[model samples]
Target: MANIFALITGLIFGFGLALSGMTHPEKVLGFLDVAGQWDTSLLFVLCGAVGVTVVSFRFITKLKAPVFAPIFRLPESNAIDKPLLIGSALFGTGWGISGYCPGPAVALLASPNWELWVFLPAMLLGYVLHWYLFKPQAQKSAAAAPENTKAEPPTCG
Candidate 1:
């Protein structure tokens, strides 16, 4: 049931990406490029997304748990740390260079692009590197740390 929901959600998301012109690397790159010919359409798309999330999360969080999941999953990190800063820098740099993020990159596989030849390989390399190099250390650190450390217990209102 959850898998079915995920499948439907992914399909809808991919369709939305395709409809929004986000599947095109050129379009994404254009939005990032400041000095060159700029495309502001994606800004509206991003703004719309932010707006939706801002509104939806407020209401949705009122629910005790997620509709399709056993637990209420959400990001607990709010502080800017060294890892966060560095990772964000790397992500931004790669996105600026290739105009490809993971979601759109996967969607790109549905279409054909020369950049995907470069993007997909590099993306996979990053994933492999993270899994092989960082994941074990991360897991050990997580295991060593106390549980429920990332977030505090919710207060009774």
Candidate 2:
């Protein structure tokens, strides 16, 4: 089942994050610190991830559907809009300040310390705020989706 595969993949990813020192906020902070005592280990980790993605993406694209799912859920939009730019800036700022991106933050939750507690709540608050701002627009799009599917005839009048 898709759920089982997702769980298994999530576990593996969490374990990998833990092993890669990503679970440690200090390590990530050090990586972000360019002029200070900068750590370059995370760069290698990122490169490794990119390498894997480059190879895997080729194979994944060839597949009609995922192994566990009927269809592969891919991003619908590719445009670099204002919201995307703002979101990326916000994410980068938060990551720079707390050194806890979403993936490592989730992994750190398993053995949560004070920092994790604070960061998680703030992270969740950001998500809630985003939903509050964007959910209405998303719902409107969904409501109009059926209309888009039904093609209208040429208007000559």
Candidate 3:
């Protein structure tokens, strides 16, 4: 049941991305090209998303449990750490260059493009490399941390 809900949610999100021209690299690039012929259409999309999130998140966080889960799991940390900064910089640089963030990139996979053929595999390779480089360090840090300081593992439920 939870899986079905997740699938439905993902389909709706993908549909929204497609409808909003988010799946088009050209459209995204146009939006990013500030000095050139700028496209402000995607700005409305971003504003709409942010507005909705700002309004909905307050109510959502107040709930004792999520609709499909026993607990309302949320991020425990709000720290602006080195890893967070580095990851943000990398993500922004990639998005600025390719004009396709992960969500829209995945959505575009339904209607495969020449760019996606390159981007998807590269994205997957990046994931593998990040895991390989960071996994051991993460494991060691987790092992060294005091039990009381350790955060509870996030669950899909």
Candidate 4:
């Protein structure tokens, strides 16, 4: 049931991206392009996302735990480090070049484009490398997860 809900959620998210012009590389690029016709519409989209997240987190914090999972998968780390900086830079560079973030990349895959083919393989390779190379060290040095994290109490109306 949870798996089915996840799939349905993903479908809705993908459809929303596609419908909002976010799945198009050109639209994203235009928003990123500062000089030659900068578009501001994506700003609204981003603001909407951030606003929703902030609002949702408020409600989520009131809950003892998640509905579907043992615990809500919230980030435990509060400190920013070198990897965070480097990863953000890499992600920004790639997004600037390809105009495709992970969400839009997956959403665009449904459109029958070769870009998805190439990007998906590259992304999988990155994941594989991260697992093989960094996963062990990360696991070893990992500190306690966030204090607020816990198993979900049953669903409530």
**Model 4 bad stretches (over 4 Å):** 139-157
Cα RMSD, each candidate: 5.2, 7.3, 3.4, 5.5
The better candidate by TM-score, 1 or 2, is: 2
The superposed Cα distance between candidate 1 and the true structure at residue 82, in angstroms, equals 0.9
Tens-digit per-residue lDDT, 1-157, candidate 1? 8999999989999998888888887899999987899898999888877889899989998988887777776666676899788988999998888787888888878886787888798899997887688776667766777986423332210
Task: Show where candidate 3 strays beyond 4 Å.
Answer: 141-157
> What tens-digit string does per-residue lDDT give for candidate 3 at 28-94?
9899999899999999989988899899999999988888878776765677899779988998899
RMSD, candidate 1, Å: 5.2
lDDT of 4 by residue, 1-157 (tens): 7899999988888887887788888889999999879988888888877889799989998898877867665565565899779878988998899888888877776785888899878977876887689866655444343444234221321
Residue-wise C-alpha lDDT for candidate 2, range 1-157, written one tens digit per residue: 8788889999999998998888888899999999999899989888887899899999998999887767765666777999779878988998898889999888887899998889899888987897789878777766787875234321211
Sorting all predicted structures by lDDT, with the top scorer first, yields 3, 2, 1, 4
> Looking at model 2, which ten-residue stretch has the lowest summed lDDT?
148-157
The TM-score of candidate 2 is 0.90
Q: After superposition, how far is residue 29 of candidate 4 from its true place, in Å?
A: 0.9
The lDDT for every candidate, in the order shown, is 0.81, 0.82, 0.85, 0.77
Deviation (Å) of 82 in candidate 3: 1.4
